[model samples]
Target chain A: MSIRDTLKDIVDNVEGALAAMIMAYDGIPIDEITVPQSGFDLQSLSVEYATVLKEIKRAAELVKAGAMEEVSITTNQTRVALRVLNEDLFTVLIMTRDGNFGKGRYLLRLKGYDLARELA
Target chain B: MSIRDTLKDIVDNVEGALAAMIMAYDGIPIDEITVPQSGFDLQSLSVEYATVLKEIKRAAELVKAGAMEEVSITTNQTRVALRVLNEDLFTVLIMTRDGNFGKGRYLLRLKGYDLARELA
Candidate 1:
């Protein structure tokens, strides 16, 4: 099984999501499986989300630390979560409004850190 | 010397700041600060800012990791940079638009990591 598949399975098992997708930092879509469209502005959101991770990566370069582990955005309509997969890859998760966000966030963050070691 | 004073001096010493203040994570003003208001909101800005950190801290716990190192917000009018000084303390550098943001972000992020050692 691919890494992305593993992640999607874990998150989808939660039973309250409308849809979930893995988005790349460069606005590319990767490993997406959703029942129906969440109607999010993915392109704009990805760009804005990418900008933050790009800056964080730049900051990490300046600090000689490494790449970012995760980045997320929460809005009134919905919340988009990102986990940096590697220097060149990050994943964006889109969820329906009013889902179990706290649990989902915790799982992604913990998984993202472990993923960072592979990406590093 | 107090840590807050030191942070305030570093940002204020810049040639063209309208104002600079170090804000705590809980929307509390931690250090002495000043200036004619840039006319941008601080309280609302701070609360929104704090919410992000609170979430990040909670994620770190689930990850069994340390606290956040830094966070920042870039707006059309201005930028608010937060560096996690310790679990209880963080520094908010509010700088006017058109200043040297890249340089300032690098400095605060670098210093904030160093300060974490002192904090731990």
Candidate 2:
């Protein structure tokens, strides 16, 4: 399936209460199909959010001579952030409060691996 | 110069009061030289830290159809987290409380790009 199609599956499966957004690691919105909308600052966040990924990539270089996987940020603000690296790409999602935070993360990761390989 | 050497220069420059550490995004410590060593959990944290990077890589894929840059995370705990991607590497630094959070980050990025190229 195409990448968009895969993303659709993610958002659809999440259903209502779960807001699905594909952001540019920089926090720029890629494509998100949901209601109630997300009021996050994707444009600015996209750039700032990237800092976390950049550092993680650095760690990977040293250990294993370069073999790193995923990284995340958890705040008391009811938001859980995860960053997955695929080549030179970054995929980020901001799960709404009602979103199945744990399940959503698991699914996204599964799909992420597939997407990464597809791109490769 | 080896990546380690470059890092040593960074720690030395940062000097006293600034605690320097090179940790895997997973929170695992790579190597850190300082008088008062940091007492953070590297083993468990390493795996968790990687999550942030993974989600970011996902974001990059969706936007620009696959072009992404650095990602960062900032906590009010006097600790600023940065992720600089270098090809297949991940470099993460937990800057000391007194470290030039901004400058340390800048140098890391410049060095990150160079290191990425070197590894490649």
Candidate 3:
């Protein structure tokens, strides 16, 4: 399947998932999927979240904490999870406030490797 | 109680919690405590984790996501949870690999307000 298809598969498979995107380190999305009913701007959200991944990686490197593996943010409205796919890419998943964080994180981590390999 | 005592209280009350700190946004720990057996560096870890919080906050602002409520990063070895206490400060908690993430997060969120109030 293509990158966009893969991203769509993730959103479709995970309940409560509103959007998914494969983005570069520079805050650019290679492909993305958003549930229209969710009313979220995937493009802007991806760009904003990319800044988060970049900064965390930078901080981890500076402190010798090794590479950042995964980051999950829980807000009152939604849950955002990020997993570093490789040096230049990462994936973002936005889920509903009641979404299953553990499941969302697990699925993302499991699929991240495959996604990276496919894109490579 | 004092900030140090407050931090220590968090570590003591939360099951599997290894360490806790109240730190500035610049990565300086105002008060912190680590379980002697945990052998984790609160100073460096706090500093490193501070970078994660700062970066996330910046990214959130850029994306118009409003103030970051909480951030959680889970690695094979530990789980780090961060909550913004104020404009210039935040809190960090470190737990074991098998730590209770849901509980840890809840406790941090609950105590964050009280801690912030006391510090203020």
Candidate 4:
């Protein structure tokens, strides 16, 4: 399946998932998908999250904490999961506030590999 | 108990917990603690995380995602959980890779109020 198709499938199968995007570390979107009625600005969000991922990578390196594998942000309105696929790319998923974080994390980890392979 | 005492108690009680810190939104450490033998750098990590918290808050604001309540980063060697206490302060906890994230999250939430009150 194409990367975009896989991202669409993920959003379709994951309950409460609002959007998903494959972003570069430099704040650019490679591929993205969002539930049509969800009303999320995936473009702006992807850029903002890419900045986050870059800062996290720097912080991890400074602390000798090894590379950052994943990050999850929980807010009053939503949960965001980020998985680093490689040095230059990562994926971000946005879900409902009460969404299944464990399931979201699982799917991101599972699909990250496939995405990485396809990108390679 | 004093905030320092409470922080110490948390590390002492939570298994595999390496360190904890209370930091201002501007990347200042208000109070912090680390396990004697853990060899973790709470000072640097706290500052780095404060920057992260700041950025996440900004991103959430731009995206209109309401307020950011918590953020968790899982790496190869540790799990770091961050809870925003108020507009000016937040708490960060670092745990061993195998530590219980649920317990860590629970403790931060439980103590966040007390710390906020004391700071006020």
Candidate 5:
């Protein structure tokens, strides 16, 4: 399907997932989908995280670890799973802390490939 | 147990575990241990990652996501798992790409408390 459909599929399928978005390493969002009343600014979070992810990708390369494929962050109130779509793009999922994080992770990987292909 | 002993314990118990360390958000290493032939500079990696971790913790707070409890990055050659012991300090486990990452994550949480206690 389309990029938005893929993003929507990820958010809709995962329990407690508030939003999903495709973002560039340079802090630009290509597209996003959020549930109504989700009540969180996921785009801002993604932009802030992109800066850190860029550094992380560089660090991984500097150490010869090769390309960073995934990075997940867990907090007391939420869980974020980010999967690299390619060198310049990535997908992020935002879920509640008590959400089905494992399932969210699984969906990110499953749909991340779909989103990547659509982008390509 | 001594902090060094606990750090060493984490590295020893997990397959493909190359190094472990306790570090502050400010980038100072509290304690660390590494295998003799790890052939990787884990210290530099940790130091570089600390900056990103600090930013992540802040972003989580800014989003009202609460404290950032853990972060994991996977690359082609290595996996790095970090667990926050407290606001200022966190534990890091570095393993080869094929390492037992689940075990490393568990040990970081299990022994992270021990190290936190030692520090407290």
Candidate 6:
């Protein structure tokens, strides 16, 4: 299966998931899948979030905390998870506030590797 | 107890804990505690992280995701958790990569309210 397909599987299986995409640390999208009426601009959101994630990734290294593996952000209306696939790439899953958060994380972990392999 | 004492209690109770602090989104610390030989500058780390976190908080709002409640970052040698206390204040916990992350998170939830109440 392709990267896009894997992302689709992730969004389809997770309740309330609106979008999933592979993004670069520099705010570029590699591949993405979004359901209609996601109610937000996934690309722009990913870009904004990438900038912050880059800062965090650098901070973790500066502190000798080792390479960042994952980041989870929970807001009142959304829960987003980003899992590092490589030094320059990470997979992001955007879900509703009431989405199955645990399952989203699990899918990210399980399928992120497939995305990473395709990139490699 | 004072905010400092509360921070101290959190660090002392959690295994491998390095530091805990209450910081504003603008990078000013309200209160903090760090054990000897923490091996890193907690203030500088928090300051840098605060900047990134502020961006994230704003992005969440911009996307209408509602107010960000929590963020967790995991790396090779350390794990950092941030819990929002209010619009201006948030609590941070830093621990070793192998620290009792679960307990650390629980403590933050239980004691963060105390810090928030004291601020009010």
For model 1, residues B1-120, the per-residue Cα lDDT tens digits are 355555666566653344454556777765535546555455555555555566555543333333445454443345446666765767666665567765666667666665455445
Q: Which candidate number would show the highest DockQ if scored against the true structure?
A: 4
Better structure of 2 and 5 per DockQ: 5
**lDDT, candidate 3, B1-120, per-residue tens:** 777887887888888898888899887888878888776656677777877787777777665555578898765467788887887888888887677777888888888888889888
Instruction: Looking at model 5 chain B, report the run of 10 residues with the lowest lDDT sum.
Output: B40-49
What is the descending lDDT order? Answer: 4, 6, 5, 3, 1, 2
Clash-forming residue pairs, model 3: none
Please report, as a value between 0 and 1, the fraction of native contacts recovered by candidate 2.
0.04
Off by over 4 Å in 6: none
Q: How close is candidate 4 to the true structure, as a TM-score?
A: 0.93
Score candidate 3 by TM-score against the native.
Answer: 0.85
Report the C-alpha displacement of residue A108, candidate 4, in angstroms: 0.8
> What's the lDDT for all of these models?
0.55, 0.53, 0.81, 0.89, 0.86, 0.88
> Each predicted complex: what DockQ?
0.05, 0.05, 0.52, 0.85, 0.80, 0.77
**Model 4, B1-120: lDDT tens per residue?**
899988888787788898888999888889989888887776777778888889989999899877999999999999999999888999988999899888888899998889989988
Query: Could you tell me which 10 consecutive residues in candidate 4 chain B have the lowest summed lDDT?
Result: B38-47
Q: Which ten residues in a row have the lowest lDDT in candidate 1 chain A?
A: A59-68
What is the RMSD, in Å, between candidate 6 and the native fold over all Cα?
1.9
Per-residue error (Å), model 4, residue B70: 0.7
Show model 3 residue runs off by greater than 4 Å: B13-16, B37-41
lDDT of 5 by residue, B21-109 (tens): 88988888888898998887766776788987987877777767777899999987889998999878999898989999989999899
Query: Tens digits of per-residue lDDT for model 4 on A4-120?
Result: 998997888788999889999888899889888888888788889999888888998898887799999998999999999998899989999987778888989998889999998
In terms of docking quality, model 5 is medium
TM-score quality measure for candidate 2: 0.43
* Ranking of predictions according to DockQ: 4, 5, 6, 3, 2, 1
User: Tens digits of per-residue lDDT for model 5 on A1-120?
Assistant: 899988888888888999988999998998999989988877677778798788788878876767899999998788888889997899889888888988988988888778878889
